[model samples]
Target: MRFSPVTQLSTRFDSVASDIAERLPDTTAGGPALAAGLGIGHVLVAGWNLTREINEFGAEMGPLMAFGLIGGAGLTVCVLAVRLFYSEFDSKQRWLVGWSAVGGATLFGAIVYISILVRLAEGRVIAEPIFVLSLASGMGAVAGVVVGELYATALQSAAVADRQRDQLEFMQSLFRHDVMNSLTVIQSRAEFLTQDTDGQNNRFAETILEYAQNIVGLADRVERMSDVITGRGEIETSPTELRPIVERQVTPLRKSHEEITFDVDVDEVTVVADSLLEEVVGNLVKNAVEHGYDGSDDFTVSVWTTSTGGRTQLHIADTGTGISEELRGEIFERGTSESGSGFGLFFVETMVDHYGGSVRVEANEPSGSVFVVELVTA
Candidate 1:
């Protein structure tokens, strides 16, 4: 399934944003600061109205004015505290804590300020300051709980996205792997049937076998191609000795290309990699035999390894026509190969990146292209 450019860009942007957000402080802090500020402002306005009323009609406006001043001062302190505390929160947990404290303090302060004004306006100035403070604190604590819940929800959402991506990759791998194995069996069976010597049956078997081989080949290509799409087929690192893997991957290619020569350099070079070493080596050798000498009768492709500074390098050098500088980068990109499907070196690049390895296409000192892979090992 291919996504449209717009969809791909959107998904890419979203992925980047989510990754950044995951590393950022919790957004819950924003909520508390906003809620607290609004709550406090409202409370202050209400208290101001009450204070004005007491000044206009009350016998003792002095105490009410004093109370209003204190309430206003408390609200100011809450605002400053929220700004200071929110700034200190550099991570999600700290943000949540900061917001909770700020929101609670602001809400409590605002409510108490409002309560004081309300009491003064309604001739309830005798009401104790502690009583008003308790009510405001309770409300602020409740609001803090809501902020905490929001943070939990955001964390849950991130977890869900991670799970979904894992499930999607798992499904793609299952289908692609099973299909390749099935095709391999079918191709093998068809080849076995082709060995019989009756003309009619042989011809029919041969044709069927040819198409079957094509289909099998197509399936193999599709499986390889799908790896990049599903992001499953990159270098997977493990303790690996190069000789056996190189030998096994290249053994099957030897029978058909008798005109092409094989040169094995190292006996037992060890390295760490996923299965990329096999794919990279196999493709280079195959490419050398098929296209290196422009379908010429005589050519040589070498499979060799070397070790330097805790890292082992695998070299696949061909005696084919050397690659032009213009095509070096493009050749490793998908749908850009001179051969079938142009995905060979694209897969190589993906594999190299997966193993934390590096690849460079340099002119073979004097002749063909040299494909080199460097891998770290213990």
Candidate 2:
């Protein structure tokens, strides 16, 4: 088959991208080896230069001083490299600074050695042996400064990440254990009051119980958000049937929002998702009913699922005033909504990402918006 230039270039680009992606993770493991190689190179070049000088000038402080400076600088750089390799400063800047310092030191040493040899060959003793020692010391000092800066920056970044992770973990524990327990007690008391009361008092007790349940739900979401931020939660995938889960979530909404109609048309397909799949579908439906309704009894929400090419797509669409183009762009971002509790869609997005899926917002036919969640079928 004939191929165009663009096609050839794209093929080559994909090949290169695949190669890089496969090798990228192992680059860090190669850091210590690379550093050691550079150190050995410095030692060999410096040793050769010093040996030649010693042959001509006999045993002197110059050759010994040169040997000490090269050995010390190379050892220092190697130690720093090893530290960096094991440290948590996995950043491009750290590698750049480290390699640049090593290159600069080696270049400086090579230039100095060449200059001394050129002068000696011409029978012109340009300066004393002390001059050579001074030059090596200067190069070592410059390399030391660069290595020091790299070490400090790496350490600082690692520390900051650790502190943030610790704080998030503490917050997650507090919410999951302490706050959840307190909310449970309040909900239980409210439920008891609802059971014991009559007439107007009973309605008030039910309202308290409803709000309590909402608070508990909010706490659970907050805990999940903390887990996502700290990267402490592991995604446990399983084959989850979609139709029953969707129906279970929608059934409660039907009772709560009698004014809104829900149309479900999901296939009995299983997806590679966790238990949190229900929360994802529930949030999408709740958000639609809460935001899509315009105080009209004619409001309708539709959910459907379709499978194609090894992927399952679950769509939740609403029939009310559609979202504006501006709002649609930032709607999934946390804290982007006017409502203080803007973590609903954020949780949905995080869970979908964990499940190796994707979610997008699109304009529904005629009016309202549609949330399309695409996941891999197991």
Candidate 3:
């Protein structure tokens, strides 16, 4: 899924705020303390400015006073809402609440700055904008934080619901498309084998075995994919040694396909990933070995890694019949290509992204194709 630029900016803002909140001296008191400060700030900024409007400039009010009132009300709501739901708010919600101050400050700061500039143009020598901007912004920040936390709560709930729905749909699809179909094939093949007069039919047995293996492989792949996809919690990652993992996964493939030449030059590099990284390496190697060999005995699969710009790029090149030009675009999507369940490519895409990395297929220098996976260097 893609996000708009505005959405992306807001997300970044929330993330930065969350980080700061987490790093506070008292991690427990960080968010609430900051929230309380914002409430006090709103009162000070609005109260001081409003006092001047009434006592110094007479009973008539101004935009600054109105802005102060709005900011105070927003701050009140924010504080109330946060206090009410403080116990239930997770890290995601807390960060969003932190962003409220940011939003409020930004909006009100601009308004006050613009308003003061207009007064100066009209030959009114009033208070300095900086002093007022600071206070007015405080009022806005409190209000902004109020809205942020509330919105965060709603958004987080929606995200959880969406994830659960996707999981349900994913399970439904597996049962309907993989298990049901494989079971039907297995049942039919078993009947044929049983009905064989001499009991010497290998085709039925082979077909059943093939389908069973597929189901098993699908189950393993689904588990690996689940580890990458964000379910109810965040995926944890550690610095995984890439060279050892790559070497291990490819060892079996090399032994099974002795006819095919294997060239490996992986670096002894580490990356921010987990044990599932092994599954990624395994699937990629299996994909190349299985799909790259067609008819000839001159098949070769090359694996290499390069580290540059804090990224470790793993390249898997195959010298055989390459993927069709038409299929390359949608290969990463779920159940996309006609060549099996399309789970392998989808798994690679999902896992790599979870590792804050990317995977793409490119045309090799001569024949066949190359899969380039770029992961963050540990």
Candidate 4:
């Protein structure tokens, strides 16, 4: 399936975010911090309230009674908050709540402390500093928990997206593997039939064999595409001469596509690439010959390479029906071709990316399209 560049970028970003999320601890895992922050806030508020009550109302009530009343009230509030909000959140979100609660409580305490100090310096009578601090801490804790829970919801959303992407990739891999295996079997049987047939049956067998071979070729392309998608293989780079590689690819293609005129104008330039460079060049040329011609032998495909600064540029231009402006941007993307199984340019792109090179399609002079690939010289 083909995705627009914007969609592709979004998917890639999500994948990366999911990876980072997986490595980090879950949101709810911040249990210790959450517990400590809430516990401390409750203690401060309860103690301060009880002390203030006694100072204002006298010691008619026992210390234990006053303590129980204040402490129990704070505990009840915390219990309710947990039941109403914290319990509703998932594990990943719970961690956000925990940390945010701590931060909120700390921030509240600082604000209250500074306010009380400023008021006292101004000679204004107000609640005791401890009492104010305690109240602030309690409020902050509640606010923090609420905010954290909200943040956790966002995290959960991201996690879900990641899982969906992973599932999709897994399904694609399975489908590719199964289909490739089936194609291989069909190709093998077709080859066997071709070997066993003669006369009239020979023509039928050859047709079957050819189609089966094409299917098998498509399967091979899919397999390579799977490898690229899954990042299963490493690109090994070595200094390689461009002229020989281009010649080797073009020579075989020329025989197969004799109708298309071939032109080579590359010099002997060495560049940093791997064995896959041949595959890259071959696919580009194949695409040109397969799609450029208009049922005539007058189409021309040119291959040329040049070195400038520290980079080498290889150009493959075709004198066939040119790609439309809309298609130019999508030619190198997977599954974007109108013919020839759509994997050719995709493979070229993957190989070019692996070599840290860049490939682009431009309008060829007079007509047709030109594919330019730039690679760093070794």
- Residue-level lDDT tens digits of model 2 in 92-181: 434443444555655676777788888889998776554464456436534743653564475567679999898878767875798778
TM-scores across all candidates?
A: 0.45, 0.54, 0.46, 0.50
Comparing 1 and 3 on lDDT, the stronger one:
3
Which residue pairs of candidate 2 clash?
A: none
What would you estimate as the lDDT of candidate 3? Answer: 0.74
* Model 4 stretches with alpha carbons more than 4 Å out: 1-228
Among all windows of ten consecutive residues in candidate 4, which has the lowest summed lDDT? 28-37
Best first by lDDT, ranked: 2, 3, 4, 1
Worst 10 residues of 2 by lDDT: 89-98
What tens-digit string does per-residue lDDT give for candidate 1 at 114-228?
Answer: 8688878898745446435633654564455455445535656767767886886687679768876777787777677778556788787788778877676655655565665
Kindly provide the TM-score of model 1 when superposed on the true structure, using C-alpha atoms. Answer: 0.45
Model 1 CA deviation exceeding 4 Å by range: 1-229, 232-236, 295-297
Q: Candidate 3 — which pairs collide? A: 78-146, 100-144, 100-145, 104-140
Model 1 lDDT, full chain set: 0.65
Q: Which prediction has the highest TM-score against the true structure?
A: 2
What is the C-alpha lDDT profile of model 3 across 244-344, one tens digit per residue? 98888888888887898889999889999877787788888888888878667888899999989999999999988898888889889988865778877
lDDT of 4 by residue, 1-378 (tens): 999999897577446544544665765435434545475558666776677677877665564464564465346446634553446566545544555666677898899888888998999988555555766666676677666556556677767867876886798778877877877787788778879988888788788878877677656655565566557657678998899988988898888877778999998889999766777887888788878887766788899988899999999999889899999888878789878768778878878888888999999989899999999998
